[model samples]
Target chain A: MAEYAAQGKLPEVLFFVGCAGSFDDRAKKITKAFVKLLNKANIDFAVLGTEESCNGDPAKRAGNEFLFQMQAMTNIEVLNGYGIKKIVTTCPHCFNTIGNEYPELGGKYEVMHHTQFLKSLLKEGRLKVEGGKFKGKKITFHDPCYLGRANGEYEAPRNLLEKLEVELVEMKRNKSNGMCCGAGGAQMFKDAEPGDKEINVARTEQAQETSAEIIATGCPFCMVMMTDGVKAKNAEENLQVMDIAEMIASADDL
Target chain B: MQYIPNILFIIALAAGIGYFTFNIRKIIRNIKLGQKVDASDHKSQRWSNVFRIALGQSKMVVRPIPGLLHIFVYVGFVIINIEVLEIIIDGIFGTHRVLSTVLPTGLYNFLIASFEILAFLVLVGVILFWTRRNIQKLKRFWAREMKGWPKNDGNIILYFEMVLMILFLTMNAADQSLQSLGVAHYVEAGSFPISQFIVPFFDGLSEGTLMVIERSAWWLHILGILAFLNYLYFSKHLHILLAFPNVYFGRVVPQGKFKNLASVTAEVKMMMDPDADPFAAPDEDATEAPAKFGASDVMDLSTTQLLGAYTCTECGRCTSVCPANMTGKLLSPRKIMMDTRDRLEEVGRNIDKNGEFKPDDKQLLNDYILPEELWACTTCNACVEACPVSIEPMSIIMDMRQYLVMEQSAAPQELNTAMTNIENNGAPWPYNQQDRLNWMDEN
Candidate 1:
């Protein structure tokens, strides 16, 4: 994100991340890296503290329309008043809501899920990655529904994975056929519906079958679900779920 | 009570049969003019849906008041057919033994008594149906949603139904009178309380008068059935004929996926380079014209979709499950199908009668369905999943979105920004392409 700012290719904007932005120790490290990037480039930004609202993704899904509209409008007013024309969110739910769904209430702005924005910066010479220091890392990409089907942007994160010297093992049902992370439709906040297994747990099993070292995805919601899935299947030691952003931040700097 | 009434029933029966036959033929021709329904790969005879929907009367069972009433009326029709045959045979041949041989004397008399009782129940049911439709004015009725030729059709059906009910009752009254007068004999007459009550009126009637009344009653009842059948085609009650075939041909699979796009010839030819492997490069883009990816108008729909619109029983089951509708969003899957049917009928009427179809003349997009309604859909399969008939509303919504975005460039404003980001940077963010791997460099 800083590299793009350094090159004057990306806009300078305030960033508002959701609670899952700082999930665990590993996520904290990646968030620091992002902050470090911002500091190095001297880019202007602010993180929304606990005051950041839920965005009502859960309420909207559960048919609680009253709460969704109120929460949406509140966020809209706050963001619009702040003159935050562009919002970069680590959470796909936040990105999809602010970018896609909020427009119905007359709140419109430029929004990007972080991987898409980061992938773009990598494609341009504005950001350079030192590569090939560690080779033969077998990796499989998980397509988050919001990033792929709902939004129709699928290829950039895959290309970024390839550029990171990661072996890109394609899933059989990649792209539009990608399975949900069991977090969509606000399933993340509430207990899952009655079923023999969680969808994410099933998806993680699909990933583990690939024998990849790392399970990489774009959305924070997917990150949380996939991680829980890995734990549930008792494959936490054998398998791992990491956001593509965190993996990219791990690359050996030139 | 008199021979004149029986004579009137006979004349009415003859006229009703002829009237119904002609109308049914006309409706058949009109429906046949539409596109042929594509054969479904998943289709098989569903005896259960037929049993539940037809004999069990489950669709009507949704509204308890009407459903219960209609059940009695429907069962009445089914049971009375035997009585109808009996009456016809008795009036023509002066013998009742033709149908009575199928069962024992006691059972036959029981069925006859049951039919007479059921006929009275049906008469009361039809009167209530008419009264409810005209007086109560239930807006949820399928007839209320209809436009064009069917605007006043609910009343017409009501009138027809009421007349048939009257004929049924009067015919039963004449039959009871004759049976009581000993003109028509049963080996074991069962308890027909209403028939027994009306029987005393014809005690002293002349033999000629009793015979004439019986014959006329039989004729009137038969003619009423014939007229009712003819009227079924024109009324919104056409669903009676269309629903069976409609349900039979309903998409067997869940309605979510779009029709497989035809191959493009240009892409096929382009792939024929020396580097091409036939197995790897299956001919996908062989489309010659800009294929209608989604429906832009009524005729833009595939024949299966057209059948879906007509097949909808207006059950509102789709609406009940639709997330958009649940969220107070403008998109109601049921309403979409209903509107599509209305638009199709309107367009067909204009084209066939006026010899012109100009979509511009009608604000079809805004008036029929707004852009907001189309966009509100999350493309969830909930509506399709819930629908018993498997009508795919999502495909229709997506197709229109495609046309709006790809052809007209009339998508929401955020799409413009997203597309720009994609076009210029190959991602949906205004960031340098080089920074795409920034996160990889840090760890």
Candidate 2:
């Protein structure tokens, strides 16, 4: 944000590199793949560099409203300072909080989850996917609660997945009635509540029921959860949990 | 001689109305224990919501089988109450069939015929409802949350309706018998299509015996209604009366829209303004700190939320659809609403006993709702959408979570670490902010 303000010119969009995107080992690969796609597509975008902070979605959902407000206010000030409008993020938690929750705190912007942004780019012919490596592979998409139910953007992720030329199977529970991967509402940061089964395990079982070779997700938190579920079930070697961005970047050979 | 009956009638009326009024006052006072909120917006929309959801039974019918049965009971309960108006008037004036005299013969017959049919339908509906709860054990009604008082309370209301309907039918039956015998003041008033079948039970009885049965049934029916009216204050049956107002004041925003606190927003706005002074004295109104953030007790919640607690029907639709609950999590959305109502009642009792709320070491958090249940919630709006009366259990869960984090500084350790990372490095990971752009180099 500081660099963009210094340049006195606006990029086409600001990429909000979420926490997982910035630091988590697995999620960094998704960030790199998406960044590669942007570069290949010639879409001018800039990261906030050190100016970017947590979108505070985790804090807010975890019930630390005060901390959430503090973080959101700081980010809003920087974004407004640079007059940034459109934003895209790899995490649905950030996309949801900034797109739906931020407007109430006076941080209005046109925010899109990365899958939505990728789908839009594909539609605009700025990006193309010929399924270079994933041709005819059977993949199942896991709907992150934030992107699918919270914001009703189920079509965007599915549409992007369809471009990979894979056999896109769906779990029985999908879209509006989709089950949570047990990572939402800050559950990702807490021990599982006492129950007969972990929610992620149940959700992963549903994905596995499709007998797909790949479990594709649109959010970093979901990727973490589905990966954990696959490891728990000892199916890591046979089945891979991946983000849509990683698939798209690999398909484009970027 | 007439004065004695008139005096007895007055006493019954006074006792019923007085007891009902006292309970209503207590409920109002308890609900007022909550903080105030502005549900005064979107008047027209609120009215339509009440009409659609509460009156029209729109949301209830989402599941066809039980939904249709509920409509029978709902419509029966409402339409049967029209007969109560006549009962009230008759008790006061020592008159029989007052409405019959007030309306033409055809209209009176039509009303009586309709009442008889609905009374029979209501009887059947109540029976099916009872069977579903006790015999068939519908999973929703038998969930872990519905275990003790909730279970008993549900059965009690069904039994109450059954007894009332039986009394209504028997009263009509006895009156029908008296009319056939040409007894004076029998008046040949109502059409006893349902109760006609019951007339045989009164066959061959003398005038005095028949009169006794008819009068006693009438008295019991009215008294039962009065008792049920007061019982609502203690029962989940309170939804019978509150569902209307609750739906009227339901949340109008999109399900995903979370409301931001004004005070927090104000502080943030000040910090964001580049031209503003940083060390200036705060505004006079902003001097006082908010009375703890979020809600740890009934007093911290808004009046509308308290109302939602009281209006909860404990139907378990919210729990049945909840992703957390479905996956076997400890969280049950129905239990959240029930716990809130129980805590609110406890607070009300405290105020009633001491003339003000005494400092009870117990609170809504940790006592009624555990952190496990709170943490298990996915914040999916399924609970809110599944509620027939528009109760938002997720809101209360979120608010209590806010209290746990803000007031107590007690969050799960993983969350604490993540929050710490966000505070120090501007993200939820322990990484240097300068290296945030390194993902680009990997490509």
Candidate 3:
């Protein structure tokens, strides 16, 4: 946001590279994939760069409302100062909190999850997926709780995946009744509570039951949990967990 | 000598109403133990919500079979109370068939016949409910959380209804026999469509014997109703009275919308102002703001949340759908509401014992609801969606989490690390702020 302000002009949209996208070794691949796609589509976008901070979704979900507010206020100040309006994020958690929770704190803006933004780009003919390498692979989409149930968005990611021309199998509990990947509400920051089986394990099992070669998700958090579940089940070699952006980026040869 | 019956009737009436009033006072007092909240917004919408959810049983019917069965009990309980009003009048004035005198014979018969049909249906519903709980053993009712008091409380209410319905039919049968005998004051009233089947069982009884049976059944029926009324405070049956107000005052916004704290918003607004001094000294008047960030005990929660606790029916619908609970986690949304009510009751008792709540060292947070359980919650709002009374268990969980994170700084180690990363690097990762753009350089 600060970088754009210094240029005396605004980009078409602010790309909110969330914490995981910015730093996590695995998530950084997704970030690169999405950024390459944006570049190939010739869409004008700018990153917050060093000026960006956590969207505070994890803090808020973990019950640290004060920390969440502090982080949110800082981000809102920078965005408002830059006169930023449209924001597109690769993380559903960021999309959910910024789109839904920020307005109450007086930071209102049009925020779109990356899947929706990508779908819009496709609709506008700015991007195209030719299924270069993923033509006939069996793929299944895992619904992130925030994107699917919390925010009523189950189609954008799936629609993007459909462009890949994959089999696109679905788990039993899909759409509004989609099971959580067990990392929501800040559970990613803590050990699993006492239970007979981990929620991610159960969710991964459901995905595996679909016999899909790849489990596609829209959120970085879902990717992490689902990946861990696949690894725990010793099925990592056969089943790969991926973000919709990564698949689309690969298929489009970005 | 004639005044004896009227005098006895007045005494029974006073005792029943008097005890019921006392219990109502206790409930109000206990609920008042929590903090106040302004749920007075959206008047027209709230009214419609009450009508649709409480009166219409809209949410209840989502499960079809059980939902329809519950509607039978709910509708039966409500319509049958009209008969209770007539009983109250009779108990107070010693009137026999006063409603019969007021209405034409046909209308009176129609009303009696409808009540009889409802009574029979209510009996069938109650019996089916009992079988579902005990015999069929629905997994929800048999969940680990439904042990002890919750289990017994459910069964006891079903039994109470069965007994009440039986007494109602028995009283009607005795009255039918006495009316046939042309007994004075028996007053050939009431179309005993349901109880007429019971008339055969009382065939050999003498007129005097039938009179004793009728009067005893009448007394028992009224007394049983009073007992049931009082028992509501202790059992989950309190939902019968509270579901209306709870649904009416439920959150009007979408499930995902979390309201920002007003004080935090104000502080943020001031900080965003370019002209405002960054290092301005804190205003003395602003010190009056609450010292804590979120709820730790009953007194910290809003009155609507407290009312939600009291209104819980202990039907494990919330827990059954909860992702954490379904995955075998310790979190149960139903238990969260139960713990809140238990803590609120404890606080009320403390106030009663010591004139003010003395610090009990125990709070709704760690003492009753373990942090493990709270942490296990995915905040999916399944519990709120499944609740028939519109209770939002997620609100309480969020409030307590705020307390844990802000007041005590007692968040899990991983969260602390993530929060620290956000503070230093502008994100939840350990990478430096300057490195955030590195992803853009990749590939």
Best by DockQ: 3
- The segments of candidate 2 whose C-alpha lies over 4 angstroms from its true place after superposition are A1-8, A28-46, A114-142, A152-176, A208-217, A235-254, B3-7, B104-107, B139-145, B189-193, B267-290, B323-329
Q: In candidate 2, what are the lDDT values of residues A1-254, reduced to their tens digit?
A: 56666878899999998888888788998888888899999999988877888888888888877778889988887888788889999998888888877887778999988998988898899988777788889999888888876787889888877788889999987776677788788777778877788888888899899999999998888889899999989998878998999998888777
Question: What TM-score, to 2 decimal places, does chain A of model 1 have?
Answer: 0.86
Write down the worst ten-residue block by lDDT for model 2 chain B: B253-262
Instruction: Flag the better candidate by TM-score, 2 or 3.
Output: 3
DockQ of model 2, rounded to 2 decimals: 0.55
Off by over 4 Å in 3: A1-8, A25-44, A115-141, A154-176, A209-216, A236-254, B104-108, B177-193, B265-290
Please compute the TM-score of chain B alone for each predicted structure, in the order given.
0.66, 0.95, 0.94
Across A35-145, the per-residue lDDT of candidate 1 in tens digits comes to 554454455666544335556554444333334455666667666655557777776667776776677565788887777766666665545444454256888888887
Candidate 2 lands at a TM-score of 0.88
Please write out the lDDT profile of model 3 over residues B322-432, one tens digit for every residue: 889988888999999999988888888888899888998998988888888888888777788789899999999999888888788888788899788777777776778
Residue range B191-309, candidate 1, lDDT tens digits: 56555666677777777776677556556556656666776644446555555655555544322222322222233333434576657744488555545434467666555555566
Evaluated against the true structure, the overall lDDT of model 1 is 0.60
Comparing 1 with 3 on DockQ, the higher-scoring candidate is 3
In model 1, what is chain B's TM-score? 0.66
Candidate 3 chain A least-lDDT 10 residues: A1-10
Better of 1 and 2 by lDDT: 2
Q: Where is model 2 chain A poorest over a 10-residue stretch in terms of lDDT?
A: A1-10
